[model samples]
Target: MAATVVQLTESKKHIQHTHRVFEEQKKAFRSNTMPSLAERQENLKRLKRALLTHQDRLLEAIDRDFSCRSRDESLIAEVMPSIQGINYTLKNLAGWMKPSRRHVSVLFQPASNQVHYQPKGVVGVIVPWNYPLYLAVGPLVASLAAGNRTMIKMSEYTPHTSALFKEIIEATFPEDLVCVINGEADVAADFSSRPFDHLLFTGSTSVGKMVMRAAAENLTPVTLELGGKSPAIVSPDVPMEDAAQRIAFGKAFNAGQTCVAPDYVLCPSDRVQAFVDEFRSRFAEMYPTLRDNDDYTAIINERQYDRLQGYIEDARAKGAEIIEINPAREDLKDGTRKIPLTLVLKTTPDMKLMQDEIFGPILPVVAYGTLEEAIHYINERPRPLALYFFGYDRDHQRQVVESTLSGGMCINDALMHVAQDDLPFGGIGDSGMGHYHGKEGFLTFSHHRAIFTKQKFNSGKFVYAPHGTAAHKMVYKLFIR
Candidate 1:
């Protein structure tokens, strides 16, 4: 089925609306002292309150957007993580904002130095569609916590949810303080061109580049949360059933629309059948029937549906065997229908699935005879956003950890590693350019200014330029490297 092209008029109305909102917020930001720690706490509390009030809508919109997002999963995965992030920021904001006292060497004892943390003037955050609420609000909360005015661009793919989000925000915050723009991709290009003190983007690597290039025109600093081919390694030592359950949950969650969803899997060749059998059984148990299974989400839109469909057809054409796990249902509908979850076997490196990030309900099993082959295979690809190793062998886990590089690690699990707000979450290289979550999220939108305050006595006059030869000699001996 073909997708209906959604056209965006970067019409004068959009430009005028955006400009008026951005300027008003810019004025508000300039006039307001970055919120005090007390104010930030109040803001976080308000945000949490708003979410709690609107939790039902969030669940509905997310459910509507993805055919099968569980309310429990949304609350836990999206809502709670955001709350925890807010709480973490509240607990640490004071210390994070405090000026740091720097040591004054004996030779420069008269001078006292410090560093002041300040917010960026204005920030632009562009969110992806998979986890719209969390993706938009997480950074927005952090930006607000850091005392910066912000503008957000929500994915058009999630228009209903995005519009609802805007309404919720409108109820809580002044448009001058924050604005949510929802339109097609071209509007996103326009949003990126807006002058921003700092810009953060979460999406594919290709779009990240376009955002970066657009920001470059204004010399704006950018934090890119890009996607890559993240890998998961299932060690032979782990309980086969347990490993399969955890892997299957991560792969199937959100219909595998997550940025850090394990793009591929590696396991010992001997254990491959057991793992596959377990995965199939566990997935079936989890989703006894796809027709009424609310836990299974649909492809975001037809374009992605077709893109994934193409990847599937290409892989099948190239001789890869696909296991159709989607139960045969009499109710299977048209284009927006659910594509079957496929487990690919005997996959070659040259296959289409292996060449790109498979952001769908598809998992490819690449078996290795030895651990070194797995390590080599992982290293050969760009470092992934997240890496999973399912085993109880602490020694092997540590060895893999030491030998390989990834943005974050889940020793015995998968995607849930991101839900821990206590950790810094972001990817590396093609995966992402920087981290944000918890305090790191706050820090990413701030500029730390180092300072010095000397006593009125001016004892540091000794370090001034009118020095005699003897004074210079003494200063060099005591302070110069």
Candidate 2:
């Protein structure tokens, strides 16, 4: 039998509906129809209230989509941080909204120059399936805070959760100011093609290229978050067990269905086996039974499951050892897609896992004899989204941080750096582009209009006349000065 394919469709209705919605938002933004601070606060508070009320529902929907996402993980990854983003914007909007003062040259002292924050009219967001609510609502929160209209293209992989989110938003806000589109890639293509003041996309590098290409038709500014093979480097000084446990927890989270998840481990060669053994033991303890555990998140859908399964099988076929200290497998109606807690040994830089980003629950340990070799290996690849170093030495950590460039970093732990709302989250080069979350997100969705208020200064008239006389000499001196 031939395989089925996923592609964009010419769905006239979805396209028309999206165009109509964008048109409405464009009108609303032109009229400045969204609520003010007090009103937005109340409305966002209400939305947060709804989220709190439907917390369990959110968890259930995510669980349905991913098969094992838990309430606690959802809360920490999606709900709580989303609430924090809203609140952070709420408290700081007034300050962020203030027209920032600018320095004026002494020669042009009479003119006052300042930069004012203005809404970018309409903003479009293309959200990814992993952390659906967070990626979708995060930019939404920023746009809401910035007094802009927004429309989000929710991922098809998590249709249930997307529909639920739409219901939540529909119940709370006006359609023109805030809207959600439910469809597949064609819908997203249409969404990106529409004329918007800005568009933010969170997805793979290939998809990001398509989005950027489509957005170019409308001349819409975009924030593209792409993915790459992020590395985790464990120093020789740290305890192997502790490093393994921390990395195992991060790698196993969401079945490694994270954009910034550590794709491979580049560690000291002498300690590689020890690290692998420790990771196996720790992962086994953490996820005792993948079929029963709520914390063990599944792949977003079968397509992803198949892709990951392919990578694993190919790795095994090519002479890689798959270590499973605690096996979690079962035959299901969905055709047994579980790749429980995989740890690969004898993995060279040439393997598929090493060559490409592994967005699954597989941990491949890449061994090195020295920190320089590890550094060389990581430096040779495209800059990663996050660089992880686990050790007790602070100076060594500084050296690593100084020597390498990544979108973000963490010492002694992984994925924790992104949780802190203070740090700007983003990747560089092939991994991704642009930063968001916290104040950076606020700025990305806004336009800092350089407003130069000028008084009645004849300096313009003085320089306007073209002549080789005293006026020209004075103007030339002024220009020189």
Candidate 3:
């Protein structure tokens, strides 16, 4: 009881500290509300430099947090995207910052219209554990590009990575310009409650709700990158071998911890067994051995490991077929948190694995009769973050793209859309809301203030007279008609 009281006190102190820092950042934003293009670019450059300088340390720290995070996967999925995002912002910041001109109607020809993209004061970003560095840096790139002061709240699950990120940020920037906050769930709650110009959170849907509710008190606009059961559909036209290999890579990468990872596969009824066979073969080709394979990432923690194990157990009890893909058949009971690539077939709707976002290397394959059936299956559920369709036919692709709704869709590919710098990445409905990446990200953190400029000529004097006069009637006829 005493310990609990002490913990609560500490939590309050942490929240207070977060609020204090937030105030300081707000003040800084007020001082320089709209930073010049050079300043914003320099900020991004410094961030890129710091990240590169501490790249090795960051990767090692993330590995420690996950017990065994794949170094190559970290480079490809996290580091590469962060660096690319910075470069993309730098390459286009000048053009993005320029005021865009808009045409004025003929009646208002004497006036000119333009939109100035101004920073939205301070921005609060809450980073998630999976792909921690990428998620943090991605939003930071957008915020800086939009010329906003930022405060980042690192996830508690990845303590080592969070601590290291804090060190890097403190060394590269001032507390007011950019600050990092670290704590548990209570601290996250407090951080979300604080009023900010804008807030961005990347995590689960359930937590996203609480964050949104807290932000609602302050009327803070948010960009939530929440996760859901993102699905991948294997069309009958595409080769089973090709579809299986791509889906396998997407699911196995990061041990299927990616929010955009293919949660389950929809294969044609006749191709279900073929997909299973091809997927197993492809997974083996990627990682022949699981226990000692550095390429195969382990579950983030024991709790997560146990949760995944329970999913398999419950599915088994429910009569779902479970295929554990341990090419080497190594014993997993020797204190190893590694879970072999698993495929759960014949998954019932009542099973927990089918009900929730399975953020592990567990692929569930569901059989469908036709493409429309596949589309219907996805439409019935809550919108997903990403949807993958593997087919070469442009007509079928167009149909799938138009008929279904997802945060993003990848046609004839998997997990590659996010790598494109020109694309805006985010979710829809239950998956998430708002967008980040490319120009959309800059817009998300910026306020597009529309401005109208009138010259010495008063064209509006025609309608400014008291009551309806000849000039008012003439103006009304000229414009309204």
Specify the highest-lDDT model's number.
3
lDDT of 2 by residue, 159-270 (tens): 7899899998888888998888888777778788888899888888888888888889888888878888888889989998899999988898777888878888888888
**Index of the highest-TM-score prediction:** 3
Prediction RMSDs, each to the true structure: 2.6, 2.9, 1.1
Regions of model 2 farther than 4 Å from truth: 1-10, 33-35, 327-336, 469-481
| TM-score of candidate 2 against the unseen true structure | 0.93
| lDDT string, candidate 1, 103-156, tens digits | 987665678888777888789999999899999989998898788888998988
List the pairs of residues colliding in candidate 1: none
Model 2, residue 242: what's the lDDT? 92
When sorted by lDDT, best at the front, the candidate numbers are: 3, 1, 2
lDDT digits (tens) for residues 313-347 of candidate 3: 99999999999999889997676788988999998
Per candidate, the number of residue pairs that clash is 0, 1, 0
Worst 10 residues of 3 by lDDT: 458-467
- lDDT values of the candidates? 0.84, 0.81, 0.93
Please give each candidate's TM-score: 0.94, 0.93, 0.98
Model 1 bad stretches (over 4 Å): 1-11, 327-336, 466-468
